[model samples]
Target: MTLNCLAVDDEPLALGLVCAFIEKTPFLKLTGRFSSAVEALQGLHTQQVDVLFLDIQMPDLTGLELARVLEKSGAQGQGPRIIFTTAFNHFALEGFRVDALDYLLKPFNYEEFLRSATKALTYFELIHKAETPMVQQAPQTQPIREDYLFLKVEYQLIRVAYSDILYIEGLKDYVKVHLLNESKPLLSLTSLKALEEKLPAERFMRVHRSFIVNLEKIGAIARNNIQIGSAHVPIGDQYKDVFSDYVSRWT
Candidate 1:
């Protein structure tokens, strides 16, 4: 699938680099390009865009600041997939906190850009697929709630809101749920496999030998490791598919 995209940067060289990157990618369509985030924002209001190429340092509005405002003021909750191009690594975690697609440091090579773009496309594909509920032949559309899951805790069928689930742990046989509000994990006698079946594959994912994490709660992910709150989770060799699937789903 070719993704439509827009770009915003102040420097001519930077703008050229972004446009060139888009040109090299067969699956990316350069719908719009701008030297100002303000102008780009106006274009996005009318244009149907999938991805956004943003530069962090601008004259009046920083890329991060512009993205924050766009997220708050744009079409409901729909916002473009943002890839932040910056020279600083400090902003990487902050970018992810707002669900950024990828972090590309300045003076990025073509191979680096290609890899990031490829990963972004893969992420988008998986997310869109998972969020899509299987269509029943019944001529009626079933509304799929994208923000909640039901976990079986013992004999009790516990309903956990998506926002409340802190993170998931993979035990030898069972998975543990750490709630954002609760003092300790609301231990479930459910295996990770069983729990995963009930949960939305698009948002919740396995990351470690003992962890299946809520992507929303993730602070940052580097290599095969994820940082959720103060705890660090590993991505198991066997479960790398989980990370790949989750990333591909949305980026």
Candidate 2:
């Protein structure tokens, strides 16, 4: 997969080097190279970038701060994968927290840059293959079974099984993916609307504005709520009819 890439750095020489490296890489398409983060943000608005080669320290907005802004901007799972390029070693840990794929220490060579770029390439390929829609065959054929979905959590792509899911909670631009196999919920930058599109309609249903539940995980149904484990998920008035129709078919 050819990744549309952008380079953002305060230093002119540094930005030029990144651009040159991108040009030499067969699979990376350089969209733009900017000396200021402000201009890069504008470029981001116009372009569909997949990977970002960014410098950490800058005036007005640091790379870390820009990443936070992008995350909050409601780009959801559509945001570019960031690969931080900094001279300091201290920012390495902070990079991963903001969902950075990798960081290149300054005064680095092409070998180091290629390694990071390859990592981004691998991730994009896996996600694309998984999300690709399967073509329908015959009318009488059985439905395709969905086993799992790859969720972009922080910098990593986590494999979440349909059987392991309890419920999903929406947090504005983010979503909490609760699983039966794990104690901690997987946090992702995506809208409930976007997530609803990714999930299979037969096995998963939106019960409320802020929640989607795994049908198999429902322990009981309360008056206006569905009980799964200890959580009581409310049924939204807008979605009650659809939920009722689905339940009536099974009952």
Candidate 3:
């Protein structure tokens, strides 16, 4: 799905970079470019904007203030998916609280921009698909189970087999899928909770808020940590009893 994107920033250079990035991305369509939040809001009223690239700090009306206005106006799900762009790191938490699709720090490269855009693209696609009516109805059939899943990383979809995954680590808004044979972990713009829902419960268990380990990949269990190959994943205090029960059943 091509997102109708609108970019708003006071800095001409930042605006230019974002516009250029949007143009380069195949799934993104630049709907409008505004030098101020006020102009962007006007653009939003005049046309449809599926995604918004907004700067946090602006004169008169900041991006956060604009977002709050949109939220209060009941644009939480109907409005554009926001991706805040700023140089400050402190606004990251606030961005999430505002239900932003992603956060991009200033001076970010095209790669970083692509990651955030891809996330917005994925979200729009999912929402659109759910809203669209299914035309073809066939005979009832069981769902086909899969051993692998596709992950969007660096603008490319990488297939990762469930058997190859050693563990999964949640780092704020992103997740790292560690593989047994691979040295580099696969990174994607997604939450651990989202990933956990995608994975089979019988095979994967959440041992910590920041960790999910493959049942077959556990090598050793030390008091507070579980070893998955060379990686030692910590077991969160709240999850310890549940994990211990699971281990006891197997032992």
Candidate 4:
């Protein structure tokens, strides 16, 4: 998988070096190079960047600040994954806090740069694999069994079975997958709309804009809410008709 990369550094020399490294890597494509985090943030909107090579100590909006901005920006939630490059090693902890793929100490060589780039490549490859829906053809005499999906939680991809899921709650750019027999829901960095496409329609249904419940896990429906064990998920007006139609069948 080719990862479109953006390089951002206040120093022209540093920016050039990172861009050069990106170009040399066969799987990495240099999408844009910026002298400051401000320009890089602006470029992010116009470009299709999968990874970012950023310098931490730039003037105005610093790399760390920019990373925070990107984190909170709902529009940029699924933005480029970061790889911090700086002369100082002090910001390593902060970089990882922002979920940076790698931290490269400055005066680094191509070998060091390549390692970081490769790490980003591996991450994106896993992301692509997880996003892809699995299609299987079963024999006419057999039944199609439900399978599991990978959820990107922080830096790790967690495997979750469809049968174990009781419901899903959308939280902006993230989703909380409530599982059977599990006390806490598995939080994943993904949109509800993206996840809906991967789920089987007959087994899962959206009762609200922010909620998708496992149809089989519904314990009872009372008024405008559906009960799934202890959780009472509200049924949105927009989805009431479809949910009501499904309810009518059993009635």
Against the true structure, whose lDDT is highest? 2
lDDT of 2 by residue, 1-251 (tens): 79999999999898899999999999999989988788888889998999989999999888998888787896625879899999999998788767788889998899999988998998988877665545442343675666888887776677888899999999997899998967899998778899999898888999999999999999998779999998889999999999988889877
Cα lDDT tens digits, model 4, 10-82, are 8988888888889999999998999989998899889788888999998999999999999888534588888
Would you give me the overall lDDT of model 4?
0.86
Q: TM-score for each prediction?
A: 0.57, 0.64, 0.56, 0.58
Cα RMSD of predicted structure 4: 6.9
Write one digit per residue (lDDT tens) for candidate 3, span 1-251: 67899999999999999999999999999989999999888888888789999999999899999999898988756879899999999998788667777889989999999989988877767555534433222233654456877675643346688999999999998899999888999988789999999899999999999999999999999999999888899999999999999999986
TM-score of 4: 0.58
Which pairs clash inside model 1?
A: 122-248, 123-247, 123-248, 123-249, 123-250, 126-248, 126-249, 127-249, 170-210
Evaluate candidate 3 by giving its C-alpha RMSD to the native, one decimal.
Answer: 6.1
lDDT of each: 0.77, 0.88, 0.87, 0.86
- Local error of candidate 4 at 167, Å? 19
Q: Which portions of model 4 show Cα errors greater than 4 Å?
A: 134-251
Predicted structure with the largest TM-score when compared to the true one: 2
- Per-residue lDDT of 117-224 in model 1, one digit per residue for the tens? 887687667556555564432355656455666553432235678789868887765568888968788766557777777778767876665777888898987787
Candidate 1 wrong stretches, greater than 4 Å:
74-76, 136-251
